[model samples]
Target: MPNRRAALLALAAPMLALHLPLHAADAEQAPAQLTTVPGPFRADAGSLKTYQAPAWFRDAKFGIWSHWGPQSVPRAGDWYARNMYVYGSDQYKHHLAKYGHPSKFGYKDIIPLWKAEKFDPEALMALYKKAGARYFVSMGVHHDNFDLWDSRYHEWNAVKMGPRRDIVGDWRKAALKAGLRFGVSEHLGASYGWFATSHGYDQIWPMLGVAYDGADPKYESLYHRPHNQPYRNSASWYTTDKRFQQEWFNRITDLVTRYQPDLLYTDGGIPFGAVGRTLIANFYNASIANHGGKLEAVYDHKDIGSGEFIREAGVQDVERGVMEGINPLPWQTDTSIGDWFYSEGYKYKTTTEVVHMLADIVSKNGNLLLNVVQYPDGSLPPEPQQFLKEMAAWMDVNSDAIYGTRPWKIFGEGPTKAAAGHFQENTAYTAQDIRFTTKDGALYAITLGTPTGAVRIQSLGRKAGLEPRPVKAVTLLGSATPLRWEQGDDALTIQLPATLPSAISSSFRISF
Candidate 1:
């Protein structure tokens, strides 16, 4: 498991790191937890290494995610529940000015405010399908511990609260109707450690020592059980409480058993050691049973960090980042357009940036799970809708290059280098940046940005030795005209047309 204490610290919520055990990644730290489900794989790494990603997930290079929930009710971006109780943080100020203090109006109060009146899964799924999304993931649960489905274990779910809709079921139906795969993300593992903030008290003169709404016994299920562990600023982010680990296992197992999602994404590394592993084993067994003895499910997690990159356990998920090079096994990169949740003043990623990231990720043998930010009502703001439309227009020409493609001999020839690993998402690429992907017997060279004139692909050059085969023909993806090209020992130069099909980026098909 990759240590994610840095992620929490990066969020400006370091106090949440308190009460976290130092041995979070220790398998022996957890009791010998086991699931009743039958399967060939064990909860240990050696047995689970035989797991392989299904063909559906690999062929589907792009997926869309709805990271929406009650947190969006404040329209205050990511981590509203935790930050709102941090005294003077941005979300805290927003919460105080808008809905009084944490003592009165807590995250529980924000639940009913999330009336997804305009939420339409069918229509949105259709739009995503049109935008070239081959798979869709809905938020099954977040660190808020609020389930966004018709949950069997927990009572605080979408079926009974908020919109009173079966969010996950509706999404699965809609995705299947649109001929797209369905998946769900679970952030419940770290909730035990994260939601402890709700138990804080105000230090100000008026509200000094006043218990927040979370400390009340009535809302224990929502805010979590009352814990008095001192906040230790350190690397641990997962709680050591065995009880919470059991709860996490039960809730997550219940979610997987019910929905049977094609994919399951955990926010951080596999949590609670043996507890998490057994849950995964059950998930895999269930997938096999559902798919006629074939494991057709993908379990995604960010277990890649430092010098460790384990491909055997499950698909390695890079959050807002990409692999340094082409990986041997299938993986994914989950990112968002603006904030994880919608914010009024936040600057969203442009269509070109999204396209570039998708291209880069696909070239490196990974899929991009993009989160389309939505409002509390489940209606998309104009920005995200426009982003999807623009992406669809771009995919009109470049879809073949992206989907069902594998990494070539080399990822690409580019001067703009993307910082590898987690949280290093921002990368500025020029027209010279070309990423490579292979399908059938052809090679695809995608420009990260719009090129002005002729472009040179150094990797395709004869002397480069990356592509030693002779080139038979060259053609642009959207253009009908054959490209005027010349190959040299140094680089393969292709003359650009006066007008291109799409303004976002371009893909050139090379047949050798």
Candidate 2:
């Protein structure tokens, strides 16, 4: 497998070079109301304020985000950058067939085609709630340079162009009415430079003179046409651009004031300037003001000093992966079953895969914010919808082992192991892998895979030479009758029922 950092840098390289200049005037200019600090990080105080992340968020183990935007119109996998490069790539082929050539249509034109036709917010919310999602996060803006909200700062917004409605407002209303915390993700920061690939063309193609229309005068804002740095064919082309950096600032500020979401997530670290600092401060202050300064806010930003800004004021989130080891503050890994958006050929994760991933993440002291991709018309694909139903069915009966629980003496006895970081390949866990969580002094042991009949746990009351706590009772979650158990010096054995509630996995709660 390719090194994870190299893959991450591949994602970050285009944006960093395009948006950060060695010397730029606007980088020094402080927004009127925003705080001013230099560099990419926000400073951390010695002691963080006493702030509790909202109760609803803590209880909400699952959420769904509409990562869709103009990008989904291509019906391709995520990352329009690399996909648009390979001529044979599904996205590239889709771009060519649906919209003429990559040159004429470019990505900019697709922005208008995202009609969001079947976008019935209330109906979608109902389905999400039914699927066991406790919160909803709508895409406020993606790296495609389009805002889903009614932006006062930019004309490239859903209300003015494509959907012709305040997408964020509709979703917020629906989520709040359903008693779900509303959040907005900001991929706008990286948009400044990430989309610079709009200027390049495939080296070998079906036809010649097929460069994308990044420099077209009429569509400058949509493509982020930077004035000082001319588009070049060099690999370092976007990294040296200056104008894109300034535009990045303007777009993010507009998003902050317009949405005021309960959660604000940046695609990467904030910009490398005082403006970035101000953006962070404003995000916190806005959350404080929105909740009358009582409820703590959440900002899912990256590269902010470790335990610095997050430990002090906000929460941290990982995209498509999780942290290497356990973390002090609560963190989340955002991923989906298949593509980030709905694609006809996309394969959703199996119920077993999803359940085990959740259990593993919780065991390591993290949360899983899963995204179930919905079709452009706002309907979930049958496969994902079915997967959600199965997951909900499992969660319904075994939720006691998950929600409102903390890691126990050890996070289970298991032979199963998951990768430690982002974009790592997922490996299957065997029945031997067990994850543990505790609540009210009761230990909940979850097996990654279902056992045939009886199960033995070697982690507790034996391996460590601790006092052998006799198994007073062992109950398989979601089953009608409590399973019988007997304890020996080395392990505790429990009888499994003839039938199981779920084929994916099972859990047991052992009370002292």
Candidate 3:
């Protein structure tokens, strides 16, 4: 009987191994302590002030982000997970009609539905590289409390459920193979308070008194307990509870220790004050340890010139808006192609608009982290693919004007003024709108639109009051023919060829 049992156990071992996730197995085998030191950063404002943005991040001006996850499962656009619990909300209505009520089929049910079978990290990374992305950011975790990596601290992770794949690990591997810097964006800071609505039930009719699945104690780990004081608005996104703050610190620390990403982006302001500082310090210290004591990691947040911690800590990230001028410190603008997530029938930004935004942001010493929305099956729709193709063509011709360039004296000259602050309207630029960037003693003037016969740059004029520099020669970036040009006190005029270099925005390299 013992011999027969041993044979049966041996036969079942292979089947069990086959069923287990590859990343989970790898995590189990890894040494408990991988780094030489746990961390070198402290939970104080003064300790964090010593940090600075890395040069590599400054040089790598553009990055692409995979802002995807189970929230994208419904294809209803951004904030589906949170909004679905809100009674009478559009997503709530959709959930009731399609899947059932939140009382029965809540976000938990949607989690298993995200198969992500078509997700090909290598292929997608190759495409992003072709689009001229210097860096790539993957969504490590969002407000839904679902970690994308092979998380040891949390059971509700990608390896254990949902896609059942180590999404972050796979993305990092692909980015490294493609020779691009890898980064991760963590929206987990606000998870505790943001998900409070999940504990709510319908106030109307048949299911009025029934509690949502979030009220079940069995799934408490996934859907956190309702906070005594729920978040009333964005100002209260982060909870004051010490327990949630500690949890945030532990989870984010685990992420940094495990991945050692080149960049760490926080969705909101450095959260929970001291705890947030600790997380930032750990991320920085871990990055330094990984790179042999020289810090290469960049921590991005959304606080602009406000608190002492924010101003001194890391790069400021502006969401859905542009700065008025060149910031004294380096910054970034993280916007999306369309909606934050996949939304059917949503109008996306045009290729021209994207290029224009990129040029405008770069001219003001800011990086543009564009989110290219992906479908649940991990494939890009035809519209986004077309946008990428067009961007690739534009980058092929005018990438020199973008990469490794600094802002000129002025950002640009245009009638269309960009509305400042978050959620501002995007303005369309005409032919007259011009942005400037300088690289290796050469100045690049990028027109927001195609010029007619000749292009006039008033900024280069002697009388513009801006100190004039002598121009040696002028040539189009994608064209070899020397452009006919004259520099005068009034304006610097350049003759255009019968055919433009590229159909999109044109770049003229002015060598001094």
State the lDDT of candidate 2 residue by residue for 1-512, as single tens digits: 01112343443344334542344653445333444323323333321233446655655667777787777776776766334533455566777777776667777677777888988889878777876677788888776778888887788889998879998889999998998778888766555445655554554546633556664667778766543332222222223333454565566667666666777766555444445555666666566666665554566655432112334445666666656555656677778887876676877788888888777767656677777787765667788778878877888878888876766656666665566655653778888788887778788888888788788887654555543465577788888776777776667787888898777888888887
Score every model by TM-score: 0.93, 0.85, 0.91
User: Residue-wise lDDT of candidate 1 within 22-78, one digit each (tens)?
Assistant: 443433345645566798978778877889999999999999999999999999888
Clashing pairs in 1: none
Question: Candidate 2 at 374: error in angstroms?
Answer: 1.7
Backbone clashes in candidate 1 total 0
RMSD per model, one decimal: 3.4, 4.9, 11.6
lDDT comparing candidate 3 with the true structure: 0.80
> Compared to the true structure, candidate 1 yields what TM-score?
0.93
Give the Cα error of residue 304 in candidate 1, in Å: 6.8
Winning model by lDDT = 1
In model 3, what lDDT does residue 50 have? Answer: 71
Which of the predicted structures, 2 or 3, would earn the higher lDDT when compared with the native? 3
After the best TM-score superposition of candidate 1, give how far the Cα of residue 332 lies from its true spot, in angstroms: 0.9
Pairs that clash in candidate 3: none
Task: Report lDDT (CA) for all predictions.
Answer: 0.84, 0.66, 0.80
Candidate 3 lDDT at 413 equals 90
